[model samples]
Target: MNQESNNDQASAMNTEQVSDQSLSRRLKLALGLSLFAVMAVILLWLSSIKNIQNLEHDLAIKLDTFNEKNMQSLALAKNADTRSAEIAARAEILEEKYTESFDQQAALKALYQELANNREERMLSDVEQLLVIANQQLQLAGNIKPALLALQAADTRLQGFDSQKAVQLRKSINQDIQRLQNLPLADLTSISLKLGNLSQRVDQLALVSDRHPNSAQNKIAPDTSNNPWRKLTQEIWQDIKGMIRIERIDRPELPLLTQEQTFFLRENIKLHLLTARIALLRHDEVTYKSDLAAAQSAISLHFDGRESLTQNTLLEIKALTSNHISTELPDIEQSLRLLNLYKLSFVPALAREPKSKRLP
Candidate 1:
């Protein structure tokens, strides 16, 4: 019986030891599970921390990008505003230039209209003035060439007006010009000049003397002896000879004149020549002819005709006296009358119009 109890105690000890080993194993498993859970929680917490850090970094980058984009947009907006301002300034300048150009065009149009409105009256006034000048040239100066030129200018000016009223006036002017051209014109100026020259040469005429054939001859007394006693003896001899002189002179007998009479004769001749010149200028044919004849007679009677100058003067006087003077000159008044009539007719029409429509 004691041997059996000891064997049973050994079996009980083995069962308790097995049960403590199981309990230790269970504690070890619980510890291992607790470590695993702690490890998992730490890992999750680390992952969350890393994720938060990444999110924070991404948010910072987005903020930086947003700030940069905002800066770029602001720069773009500023540039756009500057460009808009420049465009507005340029538009203002263009508008000012357009307005100035429009004003200039308006002024030019007004000036053109004013010139067009007064063109006819101004042309008419020019025609009238030219006609007046032409009339004066014809009547006063007797200048056919200048008068014709003025008339042609007037006609040309009338042509610019293209008026039918000017036809009769132009025709009258042309007729007057033709008549003037057909009229005989005396060269009175040339004749008067020749007469004046002849008058000047009257003083140079050589006086004629009957005592000498070609020149003046003065009778000289015979020479006496040079010695005083011989001169006395010669005088006594001449007294004894009865102071007789036997000279055979073949000179023609001429009326003797004193110095006063000779001076009067030359002055009378010059006076006649001057009178002839006056008559020539007066266009008096009868008076000029008579005066020149009287001068010729006086020169032939008192002066030597053999001189070349005297002969030339006589020939020129004869040539001048031969030209006949015509009392009739063509009437240049026809054109003037026509111009006056045209003015009279046109003046009433011009006067009936308003003062602003009249010629300036």
Candidate 2:
């Protein structure tokens, strides 16, 4: 029994020993697992701290670059603001300058319009004055040439205009000129010149009463070379023939006049011609014809009909009597009336026209 109990007791002790070893091994495994877990946790925490420090350093570098860029951006923004202010000021100045230029242009336009109107008015006034002069020449003085010249000058003045009134005025003036040209007028200067020539030739004219034969040719001189008795006989015969003077007489009576009376007769004839010339210049037809007829009658009665000079003088006087000194003048009232009408109507029409329209 003691041996059996020892065996049982040894078996029980072995079982206890086995259970204690397994428990120790289990404790060691658990401690090793805890230590490994603690090391892994420390490694993970260290790695995470390193990663955090790297991230913080990189973030600080990025922040410095961002601050520098922000400063540059601020400077650029300031410059841009200054430029914007300058541009705004310049824009305001430009707007003011444009407005001033517009005002100046408007003023210039007004001055131009005023000058144009003044020029036109002055021209029209001058035309009116010229037309008045023409009318005076036609009505007061019977001078057709001066009136024609004045009318032509007025037409030349109107040539610058293109209006219908100007054309009508020109047409009227032309009609007046044509009528004046158609008139037959005497040349007073030529007739006066011819009469003056005839008056100067009064001394050369031969009178009928002054007719005489040459007596010196018939008188014989005593010839000294001939015999004295023959010369005495010739002288006696010449004296006898001289006492009985016989002349051929065609007229019944001859007028006996002294030298002073003959001079007075020529002076009277000159007075008649002078009166005729004066009457011609005065444009008196009745006085001119009567004086001319009286001068012709005096020349025919006093002057020798056989003298060429007397016949020519009478012919000239007869031709002068037929000359017309004056003619009927056409009235220039139509042109004057048209010019006045144009002056009255043109002003209102000009006023109605637009300011934008300009003269050529």
Candidate 3:
């Protein structure tokens, strides 16, 4: 009876464990299916959002690029106009100040001249003073037209002086000239022409401003502009540097010429160049050669046509090689001969002249 009860309990325990395992497997399958569905939905949503983001970013980039291009144009126009206004104002101020100064100086000079010459009593109603004032005003008036002309020229330079976008800038300049014609300034045609030039120049700068890569992000223009005198000075400097490199005048171990000799050569070259410059100015070759020969002698280089010095003296230098000097004191002995020769030559010449009467 005890053995049969133990077997029955063991079978019952095994049946319960099998049933629990079956339930647990079904629950795991259901949870896994739900998780797969949620993950699939999340992946699809992320894909759609990513495409939208890329497109939005692309649109923003393109818009910014377009705005950058437009901004370059705007900045060029605005800057050119602003600079032109500044130049005009400056020129006007300078002309006015210079004219006033000229007027005052002329007045004072006239007063001074009048007082110095004692013309105050000779002139009627101070006509001389009035005349001087008139002359000064006339001179100032003459210069006024030139000053405006210079401004107009600057304007022209501003208009057509495009470094870039020649076509568009020129068209824009034409429009600007048309607009300028409506202003109240005299010499409208000339002023308009100048404005046209300025607009063209702006267009040029804008065109050049576009060439640099990523100019939209970095809008700085190239420094291609040149100044007349400054450019000339640069060219001159470059030329000097090139010449220095070429000549190699300071080279060590230079054969056949010491430092002093080289210095003399350079000095002579400069002197010749100076002489040539003077000759060119005067157009006289004889004068040039004469100056050059003199300069050569100054450098210890002998020149042609040196006069032969003659010694007709009581004493003469006597060398044993050419004269009758047998002693070692030949120099002293020759000097004594020269002294005697000088006395003999002078005495006859002095005797021929009329003698002064003895003082009473």
Return the top candidate by TM-score: 2
What is the alpha-carbon RMSD of candidate 1 to the true structure?
11.2
Give TM per candidate. Answer: 0.49, 0.52, 0.21
Q: Which digits, one per residue and each the tens of the lDDT, describe model 3 over residues 182-211?
A: 433333234324323322322121211112
User: Which portions of model 1 miss their true places by more than 4 Å?
Assistant: 1-162, 214-254, 344-360
- Candidate 3 lDDT trough over 10 residues, lowest sum: 312-321
Candidate 2: misplaced stretches above 4 Å?
A: 1-122, 199-283, 304-309, 345-360
Candidate 2 lDDT, tens digit per residue, 1-360?
999999999998998898898899999999999999999999989988998898888888888888988998998999989999999999999999999989999999999988866766676787778778878776776666677788788878877777788789889988987887788867767887887887787777877666554467677875877588888898888878877767657756646768998888778777777887787666666777787788788777667766788888889989988988766667888888888877776477777677777465
- lDDT of model 3 at residue 113? 77
lDDT (0 to 1) per candidate:
0.72, 0.79, 0.44
| Cα-based lDDT at residue 250, candidate 1 | 83
Model 2, position 29, has a per-residue lDDT of 92
Q: Which stretches of candidate 3 lie over 4 Å from their true place?
A: 1-360
**Ordering by TM-score:** 2, 1, 3
Question: What's the ranking of the predictions by lDDT, best on top?
Answer: 2, 1, 3
